[model samples]
Target chain A: MSEKHLQTGDELPAFGGKLRLFAMRFCPYAERSILVLNAKKIPYDHVFINLDQKPEWIFTFSPKGTVPALEYEQGKGIFDSNIINYYLDEKYPEVPLQPTDPLRKAQDKMLVEQLTGAQSAYYTAAFSSPSLTPSMVETYHKGLEVLQKELEVRKTKFLHGDEPGLVDYTIWPFLERFQALPLLGKQEFAIDKSKYDVLTKYIEEMKNVPAVKSYCLAPETHAKYIESRAKGNPDYNMLDTSAVCCMRPRKKKE
Target chain B: MSEKHLQTGDELPAFGGKLRLFAMRFCPYAERSILVLNAKKIPYDHVFINLDQKPEWIFTFSPKGTVPALEYEQGKGIFDSNIINYYLDEKYPEVPLQPTDPLRKAQDKMLVEQLTGAQSAYYTAAFSSPSLTPSMVETYHKGLEVLQKELEVRKTKFLHGDEPGLVDYTIWPFLERFQALPLLGKQEFAIDKSKYDVLTKYIEEMKNVPAVKSYCLAPETHAKYIESRAKGNPDYNMLDTSAVCCMRPRKKKE
Candidate 1:
């Protein structure tokens, strides 16, 4: 009977019905949602929202009022990208995005959190300024260093060890953005692929995955989108690696 | 094949066997794991760890080396608190911790992430410092204001609409800590609980939940633990909230 409950009315379709993702192409969190969907191969509709002007429906569904919200008609809408990923994996149960081993799954989730929660903010801060500040650059480098050290020890093809898993999918898009930031002449925190061989190989392997390779928007497209944003023409529609990772439809070509 | 993987060895126990949680008592993230087990009525063994000097065995299992890790008999170890909670709900389907609806689940997860990832940090920074700098105070206030506004709009008995859900369990422990911090004379930020009647009432309601009430350590005991840490005792035995929340059999009954 409260306004929150009323607002959170059954907005998503019924369970097993079509899944719709309300996402921003550039949002790493949105990309995390996209990656899980892709891993599961769940076919869903994608609505790309403009960051400058989020769709009204998003505010209606998301109490936190952030993008990467999912609608699965089980009589309600799902708001978090990570939770949406879990729901899809649980409901679909075809190609599990998470490892079967409980502990490994937890490790994957933790790694993803580190990237999304901690490192992502540092990257955002470093990139948000018109010109990167020295401290921001230092923070960004520190984040990368932590990740680099972690990756060194694990040495898996992806973040979750071995084949591309949830953690890799969750983090790759954000790193992809960081990799491209140098295009904007902000290269101070650019990850030197040569220096971190394991990470370089991991990125390359991710690029080669069928779902990732086919569905991911080209780097050129993302560059163009960034350029468009900088030019004051804000409706940039190119999907980031995260969005591409999640939105890959499971059903094959007819 | 590596030493890390081989330590647990191949003969991992089945999923239904003993569940061991390595966690810190006061950590909100660890509280999430406890919440799931409490909700599901699952029995487990709790291992409290000193987070400051993490044991070698824990580091071997938890690659990221964070608390709220789980060691399941099935030769699995999970690191993130959220992932462990999800795994428990999935593995034990009898008492469902997640909502049936996907969207509601998403909302629950998002709120949890907001609490764990963002708001909790704000509260920690707010409560730990003697006097917050102007900028630090602003950030803390901003976070609280957002949470307060959201709570005002929601007006639910718990974080989820009708009943206590994942978010409530995951977040309440931190909120409890925040409330208790003022008593410690560590109040750097002000919280006007009066403005958000629902949140205030919800906290009161949470205190009465048998599962929550019975498992939570008494405020005085918890304060003692915090005091020891403040006094520069490095070898402190921190209670893992997971153990408390899960209502695991303790050596000494309260």
Candidate 2:
């Protein structure tokens, strides 16, 4: 897995006969599928793409060139995080992430729906500060409150019960990046310890989850990326240490 | 089931122990659930709501006051058409609407995603013609082309199969409403026979489906509703012949 973001004119790396995920490093939606794949312990190849200067090949996997497209078979792709994640859950069936109870599954979907307002608010606050409104800030807290209430009601170690499941993975990415808001000087977006004691504990527990631990970026790192993107020149390859590591002898500079 | 749209002051109808769906008669999303309920032969009560002046209890069923909220239990409600429909499909199990193959299921979802652009274009052309752009028209046609191509590739009577499935039900509501666009003076939105012979034939077949035949409104009726809505005074109860039919003697006007 190379951290380098492939852009225009880049040839897609040869399909390695494993599941391949097309993603952008900082995208939450993309992180969702990645988390699901990791939790399932599915062997996969991750190809990070530069969204701003997307590789032409991306359209083959995702018609809209969006992140989190899964190439399940050679050249055949499934797009949309939820669609891909659901497919993975069903196809593998080894580790079922969704609730078995149909009503419970619908409720889980609703919880995710409730959090969408907060996600939108986070986006506006982080990327379009000028458009941030008081109502959006209120919506953000409302989302957190909804999560806390659900956590208290369920009384489970995770939303899916003893083990983290699809619902948890789907939402964890948003929470991971939300921490960056306060660091970016948006103090209003802070998840206050007192108001969100249960949620805070849950967040910490999620951070320690084996599946989340490996891919979770620190709030400061997210803040740096957010700052770069907000300024228009998104540093897509800022975290690419592959350039620094001399794994093999390089050719002479062109 | 009453065709009259209940407004803010309307009393909450007594739950009949059957699955009760809160919907607005002409809303495509609401119609999606209705079609599913019919297809599954689920015993359900339908309560129509005035979206502009929503019943206070609508929020009890759907927090966002959106339509197609299902009261699966006496008081417990499940919102979102897809969530409700999927829940019904899983819970019932007698008539499974989804594909058995996981990849096929994902592909079905992707097809619905592709049709969204055309749905949006139809909305703009029908509701906000002033804002309609040439690119929107192009996107609308592109969505149709995608659908036609999928139909050709699959070679199925319905997007799902010989029997209409979730994919067919999900996409059909939009196609049903799309017919109204031409009558609403947007001829450019018409499904031309030459351009979409397969789609045209498919649409005709879908119309004949017993579930669709009972619930689907004629294009003229839809166009009338669209006109009323566009004029800012949506005749929510325009088809409420219950008012006209005096099953019992009525008191004279005071």
Cα lDDT of model 2 by residue, B1-254, tens digit: 66888899989888898999999999999999999999999989999999999888888889899998999888789999999999999999898899999999999999999989999998898888899999999999999999999999999899999999999999999999999888877888989999999999999999999889999999999999999988889999999876577785556633
- List model 2 lDDT by residue over A44-103, tens digit each: 999999999999999999999999999999998999999999999999989889999998
Candidate 1, residue A156: Cα displacement in angstroms equals: 9.8
Question: Candidate 1's error at B253, in angstroms?
Answer: 21
Question: Per-residue CA lDDT of candidate 1, range A1-254, in tens?
Answer: 01111123334223455777777766668887877887778887766666565445567556556878776653346776667777777677777667876545655666655554435444454335555467556666666666777788776656665677666777777776666666666666567877766666667788887666655666566556666666667444443333245575444413
Off by over 4 Å in 2: A246-254, B246-254
What value does the lDDT take at residue A145 in candidate 1?
A: 66
The worst-scoring run of ten residues by lDDT in candidate 2 chain A lies at A245-254
Q: For candidate 2, what is the lDDT?
A: 0.93
Q: Candidate 2 DockQ category?
A: high
